[model samples]
Target: MSDVEIICDKSFSDVDSEILDRFVEFQQAIIDKDEAKLDEILTEKYELVHMSGKRQTKQEFISEIMDGTLNYYKSEIIDPTILWDDKERATLVADVALTAKVYGINGKWTLDTTVDFEKVDGKWYFTKWDN
Candidate 1:
């Protein structure tokens, strides 16, 4: 039998376009409520550690986006910072703002979030986030 080796070689600093691409796709997914596309981008180990110290799984997170429960007129990332490690992992931190469509629904503002991504088999996947 031949030995099989898996290489995770995608570096984060060089993946600015990939990160931006994911952001664009994420924006489109949110705007269109495309759960499938959103699911594909998030890793199974995804977790959102909120500013208030709440943790949510990828499924739960996607559910919020898909169910219109967290109806955001516009959710955007601003002033992003990205870092990569030798373990084939990446991190992104950015400020975010979420505006609601209707009144009485106050929008949200948050400082930079810390997101961890793993480059598994060369494809980057969001694994964890903390604000």
Candidate 2:
């Protein structure tokens, strides 16, 4: 696999490292097609919103990944910003340029993505991915 360029804002702190790491792992899981890992990292109510406003539940997204309906070759995450809504809830916003095949279409697509996370039991889980 080729390298993925990830650029983040300078505002992140040591307290934010766990969230950042989990977010990166989530991206890598998509490229690696690691369904089990994705399942582990996502909340039970996780939803993935596409650029067109279509929403897919966690299971639906993982199914597509497993079947090759959604294939991620690589990604470059640019200017990621983190915003904490509370001590346990946070949002990560970024522009992600993705090289992939989606629903039989293949190309590099740049998307503005906002991912929400919630910390529970001292662990973070992805709650929503809006693009």
Candidate 3:
């Protein structure tokens, strides 16, 4: 028999206020290029569908952001709407823009975006990002 190990990468659970609060914090993290700060908000098991067409684990996502490989000089979330399905999961829709930047990219498409998130232990984490 072969020993099999499974890695858990489940989406976040359903929660509301915490989820939105974390979303705000996530925006801050992006601006600060903080890795550990972002990781602290995630569950041991998490998933990220990046806007740049990549799927990565929680660590991968934070590392890339903090490493300057994927730089986000200026960004903002406007007209945000949060939907909570439970105490561990929710979704958000918002309009964003880039106020400034250096070498990395800034600004999303002119259109709006929808992001789904999950909450655990009163912390919000992004589970999905789709345009």
Candidate 4:
């Protein structure tokens, strides 16, 4: 993620910064197609809800990206906002511009996304992505 540019609209607290770092890493994993890193970052029950209302389990989503059904070339996170439900749960909302190919369609799209994270045993893991 050293090559990626992440622009923040406002200053963040220490907790928020940590979450943002994890979020950036997750985006980097997708671009690099790093399955191991993805697994480490995402929870076991991770799910992704697509813009088309399609739902995919963790494995299914990873498989699609691996098989090129969903290909991610680049990503840029802009002005992310984090809302904490409690000390253990939070959601990050942002407009992510992604250059990719999805289900045969290729383009750069700005997606309004909400990513859920939960703290377990002092570590934050992504639980879901609602796009």
How many residue pairs collide in each prediction? 0, 0, 9, 0
- Residue-wise C-alpha lDDT for candidate 1, range 27-124, written one tens digit per residue: 56655677888788888888978666878898987887676665555656666666768557777766766554322456665546677777778777
Q: Per-residue lDDT of 34-85 in model 3, one digit per residue for the tens?
A: 7777777655566666455567777776777766666654555566667667
Give the Cα RMSD of candidate 4. 1.2
Best by TM-score: 4
TM-score of each: 0.74, 0.93, 0.66, 0.94
Model 2 agreement with the true structure over 60-124: per-residue lDDT tens digits:
99999999999998888888888899999999888999999999999999999899999999998
Cα misplacement distance, residue 52 of candidate 3 (Å):
4.5
For residues 44-85, what per-residue lDDT tens digits would candidate 4 score against the true structure?
899999999999999999989888898888888899999999
Query: All models: lDDT?
Result: 0.65, 0.89, 0.59, 0.90
Candidates sorted on lDDT, descending: 4, 2, 1, 3
Model 3: colliding residue pairs: 13-88, 13-89, 14-87, 14-88, 14-89, 15-87, 15-88, 15-89, 88-119
Q: Identify the leading candidate in terms of lDDT.
A: 4
Candidate 4 segments whose C-alpha is farther than 4 A from its true place:
1-3
Candidate 1 local lDDT, residue 96 = 62
Inter-residue clash pairs, candidate 1: none
lDDT of 3: 0.59
Cα RMSD of predicted structure 2: 1.5
